[model samples]
Target: INDTFGYQNYFGIIPIFDKENLLGTLVIELKSQQNDYNSRFPELLIEGKLKSDEDFRDYSFAFYKDNKLYSQSGKFTYPMVNTNEFEGVSNNVVFTSEDTNNVSYSHAIRKYDNSKLIVITKEKMPYVVRLATLSFFFLVFILFGIVIYILLWIAKNLADSNAGWFNINRYLMINANKILYKTRIQFSVVLSVVATLLIVGWTTFSYIKEEYLKQQKDSIREKIRKVQLSYEKQILNLGLRVDDTGELQFNQFADVNAAYLNLYDINGKLLLTSLRKMYDYGILEKRMGPVAFINLSKLQRSEFLNPSEKIGTFTYAAAYAPIRNAQNQTVAYIGLPYYANEADYEAKIGLFINTLINIYALVFVLIGVLAVFLANQITSPLTFIQENIKRTKLGQKNQPIVWHRQDEIGLLIKEYNKMIAALEVSATKLARSERESAWREMAKQVAHEIKNPLTPLK
Candidate 1:
């Protein structure tokens, strides 16, 4: 069946038979609403439908009827289906270029005995879109991470910082002897370094991801050139000859075709613009010199610019071209907007930053715990020995500091106990000797007193 356009439709035709004689031809139109409906055959087929996720504009739909080609359908709505990829398929098929006429993201196929129809919905997401998505998430993560980091930093500072605390050195004096307090301080210092490294590592990862997503440059540039070249005739023939009013035949038709249209006079003053989403339009107000602000050749170039300072801001990669007149003189420069989807780039950056921040947060937490355990292991023994020394100084019964390890600390405790024993013994000897000397002096004094009494009696 042909539509009003007189195009042959993919009509599945089945012949009605009276015993063996042909009665009439039963025709059913096969159609695909989404992807290019492609199949082959002409007559003797049933009506069917196509299921796919690919866009309909990409490929046209077709079906086979008795091995003869018939009308094509944009939507699969005919019969006679091959079920190999779909008859037993549990779910919709992910389209690969290897199995499709063109690349498709996802497609649906249903089998009816020996024949199947394809329906595609949409194409795979372009690199710019994906990059922008990741960048956005990364940027968000970075910002969120910064906020969290600042909060944690403030809390930690309030808790651990020993600087300018109270009227006196009260905090230091209070925590001076507590083993856990000293350990925690030391652990915090170590963990801070580890956390810094992790965060820097995360930042580095985001930068690398952003760089990687700056892909398809040659292809993208080629596409830009082709688009510009396609519109070159109109620009030169009519758009350029007319003034900024766009009164000429060609200039009048350009408002819709151009993606990012900006007209600049030879003197570098902006004359007209078709772009409405212009945030950096202020640059147009500023008089431009012979060289453009971001262009490299001072002739034809494109570059990325972040006009705004806001977080998750857009970084647009815009292209510039020269509009020439009949005399081949550079009459005006037209700047074309390459990527209409500026948010994707921002999103990609954001995502990259955000992912790293989250990872760094997790790593910071893990490192903090490790730092505490490590600090405790290194400080606990020294703290115990200190306690014993304090006891000894306070004239309290000091228990021997015992340690299992044959390290330097163990030897120190052993020698310290020996010194204590030696001092005790020497003090006892000095006391005994002083008592004997006192006794001898008393006896001599008694003898002297008795002799004086005898002399007085005589």
Candidate 2:
């Protein structure tokens, strides 16, 4: 028999002896350990003999006769044979002897297969498996978030680079055409060389920058991995617990050590956030939007609404990752901002762009100036030769061409002078022939007149 007091109680009794003897009884008590009369056993028997003795040979046995015994205690008692007399069942019940006077005993049975005894202390507790699963999902989500972020970053960078290159190419082409418009064959080689060099330099610069960015991204990914490892370790070290309502709660595993961390439900509802809020003009929410939440796959495939519209500005670079569940579905996103802020990046890039613009502007100015100078140098002497030929065509035969350099233009001027001199000599010969003809005419007339007079006399 067994009884409990105060909180709760339970009792049980087992007959140690067979039906014929009815000698021994085993009892168990629940909570109270007190040994008052209300908690004492009624009687004990051994081998058909009513044993009233209090002290048995063994401390657990209340009475013993011919290797049989009896014992009594609070609300429960048991009598059994000593191990020296009965070896089989004696070895099993020997350890149940109580030393304290009013101690209660709870019975426990061990199975033969050596399975563990699981004690469910807090019955009203939530399943820790759920919490573990949630944690794993959270980590997965973070990993996905990181991946998506990186992919989107790559896509955006590619787009920006493509756009910039396109614009630069168009500008180059326009400038090249403008330079070619002067039709100066001498400057064509220099312009072509300059264009080739600019293209090569830009290409080399882009390659180096891309390689450097790739290395930086790799380094950042490694750092993020280390940080995640440390964070997970810390979360594990801080134990998980269950609340009164069977809910698993973890007070420590909330935050993440990323530049940007956000939590969202499977339905894409905002659950928690750690992002800066900025407002300007009439826009109350500056940085908060669906676009800010980086879905890597979507971002990679998504076309920008208006890429020409600048989104603030950036330099260095940004990366992203998606938070996924154990099932490999993305739940949230994490972004790692560049070491340099947007403002700083913008300022630096702006300065670089401005410097490039100034350089390009200066180059264009220099090109224009050079084109003008070359056109002037090429056309000046030709214009001079043309005007001189026009004057000579208008019968200004005495006019002499003043040529400084002894080149083709000088040779042309010398030929023109020789042709003018030949024209003048032909004119003097014609004038002499006319004068001789007139004199002949006069002589003939005078002879005719004198002949007329002589003819009449003859």
Candidate 3:
């Protein structure tokens, strides 16, 4: 029903007919509500869009009118879709793919076969900027683990240490030769060592990284100053009363692609510069006057993105120097600010740091696995020695302690076994001597009784 004439009613006329005879005429009229239902059709199609995650609920919809986009809201920036990916899609489909912008996005798309339209929603989780590094938080968690392990180790050995008024124990470590596993400390000791290594290794790496970055920043600032001073020599001849052409030529003197370049007169009024890019960044508002130059402190981790080249937040060293003439009077300030790095440097640095953290984690895990086998070798013999000593003290007959090693623990068991043998031999000799003395006394008594009886008979 084409309402080509912009009419409010759609009229249909039909002729009532009998078999081969016309009888009467019938007519029907339908009113249109000023295309309200048609206008609301787009909203109806977006019901699924609103029923998504709360984070993407607002302004995340795109409307397509059969193979072409008609309207879009929010940041649904994917384009150049291969229709083949949606060939078999009859119902709503959600997927993740890189957009034309080369940013990975989670997309939710639905096709309306009846109207030949589609609605798509997209979200990019990787683009989020965290306030702090997750690696640092992970380091904190590792430190907590170290504390727990050490506390447990200390608790288990507290009574032993107290017995000898805090006597030091043997070194807790695993002794492994190149080709074979040999010996190790108790299980608790190995756990404590692993935790300690993680904390110390991570903390040292973090400190080194911070220092390296600081040195890099300083080197960059020094280089920027060197170049600015070189240009300042040329500005000395111009007397700071330069025209638009001179100001632009001055801006071109900088080597790197700087974030901003502008000239200000002695009174701090804005002069000639890039009109299209002028004042877009709020940096120029406060950096116009002499006070700004005096109070010029360095900015920390300022974020800058170059449209021509994808460069992430670069740590920049900005400098503004006043141009003077022969009289040494203040004239104008030449501001040179720039940064240099290859594409994707930020992502690379992040990857490198995370890789280091992961390596540390993996090494700790390997050490933990090795600790189990090594603990048995060290603790088992020590347990045997302890049991043998207890039995010997209780006067119970016991076989010799069994151990095969040339290590300190093996030597200790050997010495204890020798001492037990020496004590047993001494006890046997003393008992024999006492028995001999008793026999001699009995023989003397018998001889005395027989001699007295013979004397009485004579």
Candidate 4:
């Protein structure tokens, strides 16, 4: 007896034999309507998941049994067929497809029990999302700046009017105006370092992104050449030639590096492809790309590359080259479509930028500290000179500043010492002149008293 399972039924075939001769056969069939109950659990699970995430409200899914659709979540328009291909360790494959109506779908497939499950959502390109994100941030920054400007303007007007409610703002503005020169120097240093870091970081990120994309293009072109060589060898071994008179049947080739290939005839009509579902489901065209055709067939170029190819906003890189026969004649054109994963690229850039930010942040803190130290070092001598000038006197002995270095500060101290010396000399001259005048007045008083007494004696 052989037992087999079907989508909606179970079947058992029993063979009755008499001494090695089959006499009769008995078959039993049972309805497997238990799917109705089993299906609800997953539906409930999916419903709960969708409810939890509003972004996934438009998402849909389906289940397949041996390439047959078993159930689906609402009316899903994405055309899908099991390619019977096993993927990686997880037995899951991701697909992007577009329908006749140009509606794109981004979906994932998980295989289980000779069946596969598909979960799908509307397609969105990573670059588009990132651009939108940047636009949003820019708008937010602009809005905040406008709001701050308006507030400052209002504060200024209110302060001018001496409004009571704007006292704090007025006080703050006044204090800000009185910022110390040393503090200003420190702030300027920090701001300059920050600006320099931002500029350098942006340039570095751009260079890294450019180099990364260039490497991807180079790798795709190289892989396409290798595939072309292997394909030509296969054609020669199979004694096949690509000609318009007779349709050539080429064997499918698998790549260990997880690359896909497409073969086109001399006229640029797609003959065989590894990803057939892309065409069968209307996700891609059945004909070779026009740019590739012009380069490989018309221009007779050795190789061609479209660094950025878009299908419903999803961008990817594609490489193409001509395949030649032993007679050195163009036979078929080979294509390698490389879907560069932006996730890995983004992750790498994010990590790198984050590390750079962290390092710069630390540097910024250190720079700020150093700026404060330098500001103090530059301002300390001036502060000492100012204090000495405030305590200077005209009639008292004044001390002179003694500085060793012949820098600007030393020059200033030398001039201050000269002024102090001149002031001291003027004080000594005035004192000596006053002393002589007092002695003269005393002698005159004594002579007047003696003359009065002598006059009375005479």
lDDT of 4 by residue, 302-414 (tens): 99999777777767778898888889888888888765445346667876775665566556656877999999999999899999999998899899987899999999999
Task: Report every candidate's CA lDDT.
Answer: 0.52, 0.46, 0.53, 0.70
Candidate ordering by lDDT (highest first)? 4, 3, 1, 2
Error of 4 at 266 (Å): 2.4
Question: Best candidate per TM-score, number?
Answer: 4
Which ten residues in a row are the worst by lDDT in model 3?
301-310
Q: In model 1, what is the error at residue 69, expressed in angstroms?
A: 20
Question: Model 3, stretches more than 4 Å misplaced?
Answer: 1-268, 272-376, 393-398, 444-458
- Candidate 4: clashing pairs of residues: none
Give me the displacement of residue 206 in model 4, in angstroms: 3.8
After superposition, the stretches of candidate 1 with alpha carbons farther than 4 Å from their true spots are 1-182, 194-317, 324-328, 338-342, 383-411, 414-418, 421-424, 427-458
Where model 4 places Cα greater than 4 Å from the true spot, the runs are 1-179, 239-252, 341-345, 440-458
TM-score of 1: 0.42
